[model samples]
Target chain A: MTRLVAIDWGTSSLRGALLDADGKVLEERSDARGILKVPQGGFPAVFEALFGDWMGLEGARCLISGMAGSKQGWVEAPYCACPAGRVEVGRSIIDIDVRPGSRIAIVPGLRDEHDGVPDVMRGEEVQIFGAMSIAGLDEGVFVLPGTHNKWATARKGRVAGFRTYMTGEFYALLSQHSILARTLDADAPLDEAAFLDGVTRSENGHGLLHNAFGTRTLALFERMATPELSSYLSGLLIGEELRTQSLQAAGEVVLIGASALTQRYALALRATGTATRTLGAEATWAGLHALSGFLDADRNPP
Target chain B: MTRLVAIDWGTSSLRGALLDADGKVLEERSDARGILKVPQGGFPAVFEALFGDWMGLEGARCLISGMAGSKQGWVEAPYCACPAGRVEVGRSIIDIDVRPGSRIAIVPGLRDEHDGVPDVMRGEEVQIFGAMSIAGLDEGVFVLPGTHNKWATARKGRVAGFRTYMTGEFYALLSQHSILARTLDADAPLDEAAFLDGVTRSENGHGLLHNAFGTRTLALFERMATPELSSYLSGLLIGEELRTQSLQAAGEVVLIGASALTQRYALALRATGTATRTLGAEATWAGLHALSGFLDADRNPP
Candidate 1:
């Protein structure tokens, strides 16, 4: 029976699972192991320190993905290029001397060039590939949402191109430090109607940068309620992304990166004219498993 | 000799100068003294407790501005309407628990409703009016840059209308917390061509909202050095503000709010086809010193 130890390290946290050949998690462990928070060149040490108890087994293969490969990590890996999807798992991902795993590898994210502008991503690419693997689909789009939202178009086991948006990051900054922050006393739920209203306004030619502060004026003037403003702002930012990013690709299948924080985006994204479905927490774990399955079937390091 | 106390109490800070009739400072002192920072209804007590030494001088008067008269301050004062230059200082301004000064009054800021948008300014309104007092010009435009950047048009001592932009706050949020924050290292003087370059791009029908993420992409692609991304992002935001806000008001005299933070907007203002000058600090003090001038000349209780 083949066993897989999979890791999904994200911007601020690390989670892992030891799974049986059938894809059921054996014993899972997680810790505050985000790459940004880790000390310089301390990825391996911190991971082992947090999850050493889970590594009691012998001769098990391990796979890792996420920002752990960027400059802030223990070792840097070059980002894969455009029309990029499922790069071969790097066998010698890093020469960190540590754990006794039989073999170790890291999945590469996707990248693309637009108008002389280049974009790159790491963890979400693997998840997109994994989502595709499970769906058994060809030529579709997948979106992984967060502070740095990632959108990828993949076909025949390759990502054609992808884009990233600063929705979550922008939300945090405006909510915490800016004047809009002062006015917001409570968290607001995502209002699809409000979101659509924002999209309509944006599509009607309200400049996103120009009308950003007007949301406050709207609140002050009592034209829009305070809570609805959040979703409106979301619509404004996401609406821009939909219109601008869609110029190149007419994506068919919209695989949403779903979470408590992400479900709000699906509301605004309806304006993009795509068929949407949410890939839940299981899909993240499933995406990692898909990579493991590919590796096992090939058994080759490319 | 007439003694006067000039006080400026803002949201988070308070500054006061005890001066002779000649405007010579006899003593100056400030504490953790914003209207918001101080305890509620503690204004009269705090003033007497803190400035007791400067009080009880014969024929002395005091002038106050800022949130001391908003709905939530020590007492409520009606807002002066638009095209607002300088409103006459109020006789019974604050609902003080105890009468302390020989003569005291508060200057109300301007508020206006334009195109269905309601806007208000408290202390800066006083400062701007003070600026016009020095210039002896009745009709002009004023640019008060801050967390909420405002472009105001005034005519014949009345503020006509104003629009607020979150340019400064947006820049702070993007540089300190967003993906742009991760991409940027520190502050750097942006290329004027690059800033205007971004403005030109925003002016296009494409919308500046979707294009903000380009800052992150520029760094990932190595097109921009990591450190310069902040400035570039700054350029993009301010550029959008210039293109959008300049269309809101018309006035040849761009009296910038006097501040280090506000000064950064000078270059951006100059780009908007307007002559810009920083408001002199003395102008505000002189305008408000009228408690000993205009009001006294009228022999009013204020």
Candidate 2:
């Protein structure tokens, strides 16, 4: 029987999963009602439309993550500072009333201000927890690849700290708005060789600003085809992301994200002389399950 | 008496200087009729409206440099490849008829393909020539900072090879479009101390992808104010540009560009322990004069 509804409502998309008490997904739904698109005072309506079917189950509760817990979301869950674990995160969850007999809990994001640079992440914290528990790793580096890719350290089943590289966002802006946009083939498949070439090129002593021009110059001289440019650019960006944190110099990294992005990052990491393991979107389920379990134990005092 | 019209028609603006045969300016005009704003088949009209006053003088020939000679400009003066000197460039100018018995010559841009990364420059070649001639340097590195900064090797009065770094363009894009945009003061003056702090941070061995996050982090933490972020970003980009070319390791650099930009680059170069001499926009005048003199000497057989 369904006992919980889990929603990963980010800035641009909404994803929901109906789960049993055992943390197994019974049914899933995804839509475009992300926090940014939700009309004012319409969060409850949208949430009901997406997952109302599962709400009839006895004692069913809603647990939402991602930007839905942000300041702009339905409920503002203040960020929990690191080093935090499932217990801390569960304790920090902000409760909200959705209807007369229904309720929702929004997970708070995490912030790290240790390195003199403020770094924060919302949905990825739970994902990291799931990745760590599933991988059976006591401590390691976790990479969640997306618009703002998160690189976090999991020490003794707790998140110590993490840094964010706006690699994916930078890639999007450059590919769409910069001069290099004209020379790109937007629909081309990934060319592995070109991607690896760009990965290797990232090791060039010149910085990224200098290296970015290579995209244009390569196309101008016909050294690299327009279709291949995108893959190469992806490699360069991911490679830089890896280099920034010295991830390759670290022993191993567990990549948590969609399959496609993780695969690209895995390829880049391996090419850069690092080992990698991957966990899919299921990691979020496992992470949220652990947090919900913590909340249950806390409430019953057993 | 006016014998030559030197025009610097770049991507956004056109600058014209009427000059006597002795290479001294007699009058000048500037307008926003850059190549992008020109309507199809309307280049002659725009040129006339801007520089028509000086055209009535007898034997006044226009020597046009910059984007007016690009493929999208009035006439495509093909790029002359490096190791090209003034003579090679002078020979490559493509002439066009603006009116009956009135002709204009467009200077060819330079391209370097030696480094496997194709690099090209248009207006800077003229500036470099002027900087070199004025400095009386037979061989040195010349840095021309602008939208696309060029670092060219000048050896014995000819361009040997060079590389292009998209430093300024990256700054503009990040300041205006990226997440870092909110952390910048659009109208803030250059903060020298903050700028140097950024230069110091760039040497931390972390790549730019990692370093860029510091902008957001600094502002978020309130360690660095929002208004100071722009200068810091400028320092980071300029520092990376210098680091890529090992410009800091180079003993001295001739900076050729507008005074404001060159001053910033000069500060970065000096902080990095390199000596710098700045040549203002007048270098463009000097460089164009040299090229026109070469053309006249070739035609008169003197």
On the 0 to 100 scale, the lDDT of residue B219 in model 1 is: 78
- B182-207, model 1: which lDDT tens digit per residue? 77864765565556555555554434
Pick out the ten consecutive residues of candidate 2 chain A with the lowest summed lDDT.
A293-302
Residue A95's lDDT within candidate 1 is: 31
What candidate 2 gets wrong by more than 4 Å, as runs, is A100-103, A297-302, B297-302
DockQ of 2: 0.68
Tens digit of lDDT per residue, candidate 1, span A1-302? Answer: 56677887776887888877666778777778688788766777787776565555563566778887776665567777766545444322443346653455666655677676677787887677667767777677777777777777777777887776676667667667676765653368877787777666655443555456656666765788877888777776677666555533544545556466556556656555565667755565666666664454345432
The numbered model that scores best in DockQ is 2
TM-score to native of every candidate shown: 0.76, 0.94
Each candidate's DockQ: 0.33, 0.68
Chain B structural similarity (TM-score) per candidate: 0.82, 0.95
lDDT of 2 by residue, B122-182 (tens): 8888888878778887678999998888898988899998888888888888888888887
